[model samples]
Target chain A: MRFDKDSLWYPGIGFAVAGLLLAFGQRALNRYSQGMQRSALWVEHTYDVIRTIESLSSAVSRASANRRAYQITGEPSYILEHRHSAADAHSALAALRDLTRDSAFQQKNVLRLEDLVGARLSVMDDLLKAQARGGLDPRKSASLMARARTLDTRIHGLLTSMTRYEEGVLQLRAEEGQIGYRRTRILQYALTMASGLIILVILLRLSKEIADRQKKELDLRNSTVLMEVVIEGSSDSVFVKDAESRYLMMNTSGAKMIGRPLDGIIGKTDSELFSPETFARLKASDQEIIQSGRPKVYEYSVALPAGTKTFQSSKAPYRDPQGKIVGVIGIARDVTAQKAAEEKLQEAAQIKADFAAMVSHELRTPLTAIKLVIDMIVDRTLGPVNEEQNSALVTAQRSIDRLSRLINETLDFQKLESGKMEFRVSEADVNRLVQEVVISFEPVAKGRSITLLTNVAKDLPKVRCDKDKITQVVTNLLSNALKFTAGPITVSTAMDGSDVRVSVKDSGPGVSPEDQTRLFQSFVQLEGTRSIQGGTGLGLAISKKIIERHDGKIGIQSKVGDGATFFFTLPVDRSA
Target chain B: MSPKRRILIADDDPDILAMLSLRLLKAGYDVVKAAEGSLVLALVRETKPDLVILDYFLPNVKGDEICLQIKADSALRAIPVILLSASTAALPPETVHAIPTDDRLTKPFDISILLEKIRLLLPAESAG
Candidate 1:
């Protein structure tokens, strides 16, 4: 189990406390055992003193019995035995005195017993001498025996008293030793229990720490497995490299990308796997990421066995646990298909552009020639024309104008649909632009006997828009108005909220609601409107796209019988 | 009047050349015509026209290149050039602004507009 630097001291302190408890317990046991040994020694000392006293008493009795035997049988051997018994009594008295030295009362008793034993022996000796001196009178012998008997009784009494005193000391010592032994035993048990509890606590703590470490290890292992699964399951190539640019680890996809096995890729540098040119380029970027400790995203094409594949790879600095940048980790995705699709789309756009250019040149060139020739004849540049001829030429010129308008409308719609129309956006004075469009339509209005009027708001806020495209929209609305209605057409511009609104109100045969919905759609010429003027039907659609591109809205408000107001609004250019 | 002001016109189409020449003649300007782009520069030098009108797409060379050449020549730089193109896409406003031409026009244009451009460029001639 790994112990973090911060937590290492925890177990250390625990062991220290447990050791302290053990030391204290050992001291307590030592003190208790020493007390028990001393108590036991004192008890044995008391028993030794008692045993010496009993032996001394037995020696006195045996000497007196031997003297009596010598007096009865007049045997010299009995006298010798009596002398041996006397020597035994003297040695036993000395031993009792030595053994009782720890107690003043027992020592005094031992000395008194020794003196009485000596007196009793001396009395017996005097009787023996009297017997040796000669056969004496019965009275003299009886007196000597009585004196000896009295001394012996005194000696017996002294011995009995000494034995009783030693027995009392031994009994007191035994009780004290038992009490001390019980106290020490109880103390040792308490210390042992306390030490055991501390040890159990330490063991429990150690086990808990082990369990916690095991759980952490398990969690770490599980997370590593989960991360591996996620990386392996991804379609994108994921890899890690050391600071030296050697491959540290990689997912299966990453290995597959290099066309190598996982074992072969591991510990290998990019230089070993890629061409020198590719390796140099990749190493430069990898070193940059590592040194800068930053993330980079870039696209590169690789030559693979299948084909050249484009990849968008993002690499970031991988940091160690200490937060030091250690290496690079990267993920690369194959974007070859997406790139191919984009190339195809660009090719299609080029084709459409070429087609538009062709239409503009081939069609307009012939039309220009036709219109110029027709204009020369009608304007009398060729010759003077009669009324009939001039009328016919004028009619033909009108037809050409319509055809030209159709061509221009179709081109505008196509450009708008393909998102190729370019707008030179600028801040424009809405009122002036509307007034200019109205004036341009004046000639048409006059010929048609339609009064074209303008209601331009003064000091209207300028709007951001393409001037040419806006002018085209206004022209379309005005032309449509003049064609549909004989009543006066009013073009007005004013602020509608944050936007500048331009409306071409015409007193035309009003459109139905259904036709208004489809009015801005291309190639939808309304029923009555189609017969009145043959329009390309792309005018309104192109105008709608242009207005929308300027972040504006366009619509018409009309009723079945009432006139229609074709209006569009452009957002005011706040910057201006 | 003061030797009619000479105007050089270049176009690949014969009909366009004929119509434009007739109109310019009617409008009282001495008109010079070149059917090919290769002859326009020589024609312009020979005639020393008051102005030059060039179709953007012509045989052998483009109108903008001729206009650039005319503007490049210090002696002929003052002679105004009108670059005309049939394709709006080919001669967008930015391209026209880039080329050092006096003016530009798109084709299928009205004769009045062309006349007006010529008059603006040849203000002194028009007044006389």
Candidate 2:
């Protein structure tokens, strides 16, 4: 089973088990030592009994020797010594009995020893009484002495038996203590070994747990360092707020953004850090995000110590591990430079548009005068003009017309580029518009010896567009065809899906695939066409813009040696 | 025949004013010309011309202001106005319609078209 090292229960249970084992081992040791002590006391008791028995025997022998000496020397001091020795023997026998009381066999032997000791002492007394009557014959003394010898022999035999019995008892007690001491010693060793094993296991497990925990702590520290690096390295401001909208943590950039130090910003609420008005706005937004658990991207300008700078901040609800919204995390980018650059670019475009307008106006005034004067001259209003003079004036009028067209194209392109071109949108009939433009181009086509045809589809849908712009596009297309080729030019309109498609087809040298891509770009007159046709190249670009503004598409389809078809599609006025 | 159907023309450019006056004269209409915007209104009130052709941008006064003034005036409101502009981007067709003029034309226009617009504005019997 895998133990939860963090749980108190694992270590608690382990310590409890270890404690219980130690307690058991300690009790076993206590019992073993107690057993050893009791055994030692028993052995000492056995030894004491043996010693008393030996002393009693020795005392009896000494008393007999003293009596014999008294009988030979007939001294009073010898009799007194014999009496003392008999008393000592009697007392020793009593001590032996007392010591042997715990054992039935030893007690019986001791009692018998006591009886022997008493009889011997009485015999000695009898001898002494006989000796005291000193006038007796040798026979009488010999008989008394012989009776005493019988008693002494019996006493000696009994004392020897008692000593042997006591010795056997001491031997038995020593063997019994030896066995008890061995058993106690084995128990102590077993208990000590078991306790030691349990303690070792506990120590090993605790050390392993500590090592594992240390590794995990190291991993946590490393990841924390990595996250700190990422947050601190960012140029954009990164911050986190607490539930009360107080700053919980902020990166260096965040502190810089607020014009405050990191320590000053952390744990401080927005109200404390920002002006009251700014605080109110920031708090409301933060509260909204936290409450809704949604993210927001907004642009706001703050007056920093450096200057007023705009920031585009993206904030999301900061959720905890359980997915509860705790606060908000935000990353704010300084967009001051980007916004200023955009504004500068817009200003420059406006200035360019203004310059184009002024130039067009200045050029048009003179061109208008020249065209009016030339038209009257060509029409013979001033004076009669000769044929050659009229032809040259007509050529000049055409050149003036080209110049006017160039100015108009340049102005139109500029207006379109600046997004200032206004469209007067209305529903216009595509078929009629195509026919009108084609009819207008008829004289020019006739002069060039090219037929102008209108192949307009029947029941075509009307398109929503600026009619004048569309007319200009068609006129440009027709005039381009006339200038490029003498082949018949056909202007056709038809319904292509939900759009009205107008195509101007001419048998001109077709545009190359490479040139077709750049054809609609401003100021891009093709290589061959630039020399052959003197024109401003903004015609197709302006037409593309106009068509695109109407939510239409304009393009060309041609192959080398094949006639080119310039087509445009305007969405049908579905509202009608 | 009908007192030559007088027309008032205003332009800042002398060449434009001279050319337009000559063209209108050749087209058989009496022409009153003003090179500056400050003179056009007086000429209109004095001549009571059948039509007034105005250049949209002129010195001292803009063309729309004069048009608005002419339109505001009870006496001159009936006189037809044709505003001519050198810059079409500034005065788009919608803006032209917003101004109370009989017609609007871009500069460097065909003289025939201008003549046609004048004829349409004037009564047929008074048309040159």
Candidate 3:
């Protein structure tokens, strides 16, 4: 285990405890050994005392015998034996005293033994003098022998007691040493076993922790893989950069969108991977995100290997636990389709405006001259006309009328296409509006000698719409019918649900089923037996656009000989 | 007899100049014409006309710039300049008309409006 300074697991603290226990055990063992050594020394001293006491006992007996002999016969052998016994006793007493240095009882017993030996020697001397002087007197010999023998018995008993006391100390010292040894063994075994178990437990826990950490790492890797897959398959380009603005990673879509291979872009900076202008722009954006820690979204057009592309790009800073801005994450969406669509719409609008201007300039020039000529003729500035000439003038007037209608249709088409048509909404009487539109056609229908009729309901609901534009719409439908039909045209108005329906039915060869489908498309004139009468093919298309703008609908139904019916519906007055 | 009234007609289109020339001639006025941008001012300096009809769109010189130049000059600025074009083209009417030009006319203009503009630009008896 690693060391913690304040924890018990601290290496130094553990070492200190171990060292203390070792020192304590060693000191205990040393103390026990020292006691045992002292006891053994005493036991050896006592054993020497027992040996010396036995020798002393033998020496005293010998000396007593020799003194009796010397007292009876005055022989030199008795004196020599007395001297040798005395020397031997003194030497034994000295040796016993040296071994008894730490034991007071043994030393005291040695001293007592020594005193007894001396007394015995002194008593032997007295016995020897008595033997020398009185030569074998029974009474004197008995007295001296009694005194020496008593001293000898006392010394021998004292030495035996001292030896037995040393033996007792030795037995106690041996038992204490055995206990110390067992305690040390148990302590050492326990310390070793605990250390092993602690190490084993630590190792097992560390391995399990390592495995768990590895599993978490593996899961993080899989999540990264999933993120990469999503980025690669997305329509948007996704990329990450390090703090230094070098590419750390980029998805396949990002690489492809940037017109670079993944390997090429992986470690490159914007300066290295993009143009100078683009690089500067990107660097500025990166700095902003890094500085403010906010996301930036902007559109940029880039010329790449594929082609020019426009992208809506968003970039944000990636932060870590400390809220430090570590890197940048960016996503860019390709907007080429939307961009192209917008451009097309603008171009179409401009073209429509241009066409309107062109029509006004081009058509009005000729019409103005024709109108001037017609005005002059009508004012008799050209000359007086005959009856036939006047009749021809009427025909010319009709042709001019048709030309004016065509011009109006072209203008309407231009307005509709440019989305510039402005409708003036108002409450209009539907029946009156229909009758007014049909009345405008009465002159043309009478000129053609075609019967024109109106079937407007008296109770028809008033429609909320632009009256003039709606009247123009009805007139256009009626005029188309008059131009296409030969016989008669019936103008009718009715109520249909929330709408007011107006229909112009003409008795003529009707529009074909195929042509009917494309009838309202601009510039689509049906190929039929009916004469176009110099018509611009924009009337139906303009009418349809006008109706649609009012939130209404226009439709047509026809059979070959049963005549064609052009119908339109406008919403009834809900405000009323 | 009174002197014929002098009129300067400036246009990029030659056909418009010819048509205008015939009309102005029929109206009994002396017509001086210039078709290019560079020639208009030189002609104006030479012939100080009573009236000038200028086309808004020109090949080399902008109509507004020409109007400014004409108006800026002390000698020729008094002549009435009528500007005409197929499209309004966002040329300010007041500014062009304020350049000592009595009128501004858009092309495909009604002949009656044109006659009225011309008559209005001249003194009542002098227009005849």
Best by TM-score: 1
**Clash pairs (backbone) in predicted model 3:** A71-A131, A71-A132
Winner by DockQ: 1
Task: Report how far off residue B94 is in candidate 3 (Å).
Answer: 23
* Candidate 1 chain A TM-score vs. reference chain A: 0.73
- lDDT score, residue A205, model 1? 84
TM-scores vs. true structure, each candidate: 0.77, 0.69, 0.47
What is the lDDT, from 0 to 100, of the residue B74 in candidate 2? 98
Q: Which pairs of residues collide in model 2?
A: none
Greater-TM-score candidate between 1 and 2 = 1
lDDT of 3 at B10: 83
The better-scoring model by lDDT among 2 and 3 is 2
Task: Provide the lDDT at B88 for model 3.
Answer: 37
Per model, the share of native interface contacts recovered reads 0.80, 0.82, 0.11
Which of 1 and 3 is ahead in TM-score? 1
Candidate 3 lDDT for residue A23: 69
Clash count (model 3, backbone only): 2
TM-score of 1: 0.77
lDDT of candidate 2 vs native?
A: 0.84
Docking class of 2: medium
